[model samples]
Target chain A: MQAPVLGVKALFFDVFGTLVDWRTSVARESEKILGALGFDLDWLAFADAWRGEYQPGMEEVRSGRLPFSKLDVLHRANLVRMAPRFGLENLSDEVLDDLTLVWHRLDAWTEVPGALTRLKTQFRIAPVSNGNISLMVDLARRNGLPWDAILGAEIAGDYKPKRQVYLAACAAFDLEPRQCMMVAAHSSDLAAAAACGLRTGHIARPNENGPGKGEASPSVPVDVAGSDLADLAGKLGV
Target chain B: MQAPVLGVKALFFDVFGTLVDWRTSVARESEKILGALGFDLDWLAFADAWRGEYQPGMEEVRSGRLPFSKLDVLHRANLVRMAPRFGLENLSDEVLDDLTLVWHRLDAWTEVPGALTRLKTQFRIAPVSNGNISLMVDLARRNGLPWDAILGAEIAGDYKPKRQVYLAACAAFDLEPRQCMMVAAHSSDLAAAAACGLRTGHIARPNENGPGKGEASPSVPVDVAGSDLADLAGKLGV
Candidate 1:
């Protein structure tokens, strides 16, 4: 399918599953933490369950079913509820606090840093994810992800698929929507960005759900599509 | 006098006259533009005259003496009034628009990027300047300065030495005032940050005024003092 060629001055990325593999990384780190605590549990199951709390939590706030809250607060609330379900109990507040920070320890995809470096040479690159500023900043520092700035839902006062979130980024950079591009693995994200007049690029992360798992195919008319970041970088001539 | 050792988590910089030698840089850039247009005025004098407008312009906004304005707007206003002084009359709107972006092209101190790199490994480094977000972002990109984020007076709706501007940086990083350090060559800037409970580090840019010229030394009680960025880094053990 032919896609429109776009002229983009800046690129905003979706941080979690799109730029970094949060699932496996969080699971591995949780497993290590459990091991250190002399406990055994299904790490992958815990990771999926932890991530399962994210969407509904965001939806709750987005729909005004709950008051405006930061992602860290939401993550902490979900962690407290999920701890006992994982056959873990009697955790001190300090331990729970450290565990809640699992989201901060996400691992970047192998292709992420190099691709971002190449793109940074040609365009303004930043994170326009639903993640809060501190979480995103910590993630970038820990993973060596080079971001020009952190533009997130906190600045938008709303979650993804909302025009406000996308527009907030454009406003922050003082660019018209057409001058900015959104890069994501999720069709829903690109759809929202495209609807808001931002150019879109889709980098397929087939392994985002692990082997034999597939995310829904992106349905939006993105300006570019590639199997991975390197392909996207090549396509953009970065 | 022995200064108390400060434990600083992040180093927030003052951009315009602190990290960037704006006077010299702006003078040189404007000279080139004027030279191309066959103007033969004293470029240094013109640059100084142009910069002289910055403070009064900002003060007008700060004192509620004028309506709220972005630095870009203020800069443009100043540029329009100063243009004829440099013999650049009847300039086309497009050329004038380009000239107004002179603030976006300010050059960084020679030690800025290298010192920032070293500090970044240990602390979150950002610019808490009066420049707007877009201006700071573009400046960092243009000069290859590795800033973790750009926190500006525009975000706080007030310019520095204002308490809100210093406190806003602390709030953005989720850091307490004492945990953050304000590093600047200007005593007034550091004093304001100190009043907000942030530790202050003074890096003496004796040559900020360019060759054979010097920046005025103002008295302020900073936690540390160093001769240059390299010295600051050394003192901080970064």
Candidate 2:
């Protein structure tokens, strides 16, 4: 309810569910691919299941149970395994490669780019995503994300919720961790960033899954919270 | 001469000499600091010596004679040793810190931003500098360099003229080394990049030392050569 404090020099974003609607986008793309293959399945559930793979897959890498690899490589590895379960038949390597790049072709939430443009006038904006730099760069160029830079877990050889990842971003910007704010829809990311001494902002993505979809509340108290990026920008006076 | 072929997708620039007039900038700042202390020295030569310290300092790190350190840290360590030689006296920690950031406050060559803007429309423009990321980011933001991203040798744990530095930029953009181009005033930087399979462009910074001073030419053959950034942009038809 109260106005958010200013003086944050850089805003690090959680890319997937925060700035972009990955679930809907991935489901739609999977549906199209399935249709093209003359097959059908519950694409929505498949999309959610694929999304669910992210945290655990990253855990494997973080725990050294898996070899060091890029998010794109991990995404592709997951996709190849999930394809048959989702009724994808006889997918060619070229087709799978194109599908892996679907993450790079995600649409920005309608309010995202506009809010980012306004924020860019006053602050440095970058995505602190689990996605690799190349994937994030391609996504930004494709969606006009207007990121001043792309900060990724790849930069630190680890994923989010890791203190080193957030510290790496602060180091890259030459700022104390407290001077940068992590903006995300997820509480885990905000909590991790906050624990690492960063300020935090929560932008609720109520329609992140569209009509009748369940929405969860952030589990931690962030420095600020808002309904969307537009509201967050307004609160930050950008 | 004939029009240069220009199918380069990304431009990886040499920061210190290509975009920024480090000689004048560093000399001016060093002179101001020395004057405040009532010391006198040929600040221009001092600047050259300070610049010269960069390579050997990095070579120490590169050759494993010294531990890996960021350029700013390396610069500060060298400056502490070189300050007495420059007749600087009573330099406190704060003064040393301010002096170390001289690299961060560099002024761009007058033609840089405009040419970069023009080229950005056709190619991804970034600085592939030996400078660290934080220093380069500050320089770009302060000087309005319009870099799409900052690629630095610090990210690769080594300095330029090394293959890993060039390969890091290509990896960052997810491009084949040949798809990217190294744009530098120094032919040797371009040669190093080319040896890594990148394309190369040379924009002659004849006034690299300001109005009357001259330096030895880089001892390598660059792929494309032009008078300046405008001339280079024109050659690239950007």
Chain A TM-score values for every predicted structure, listed in order: 0.93, 0.92
Looking at candidate 1 chain B, the ten consecutive residues that score lowest on lDDT are B209-218
Give per-residue CA lDDT, model 1, range A1-238, as digits (tens).
2235456789999988888998898898887777899988888888888887888889988998887677888888888877789777688888777887888899998888889989888888899998887788888888887888888687677888779999988987888999898999998899989999999989888777777454534676788987888888888876
Cα-lDDT of candidate 1: 0.82
TM-score of chain B of each: 0.92, 0.91
Pairs in steric clash, model 2 = none
In terms of lDDT, the poorest run of 10 residues in model 1 chain A is: A1-10
For every model shown, what is its TM-score relative to the native structure?
Answer: 0.92, 0.92
Looking at model 1, residue A161 earns an lDDT score of: 77
* Predicted structure 2: lDDT: 0.81
Model 2 clash tally?
0
Q: Calculate DockQ per candidate and list them.
A: 0.65, 0.52
Query: Which candidate wins on lDDT?
Result: 1
Q: What is the lDDT of residue A107 in candidate 1?
A: 91
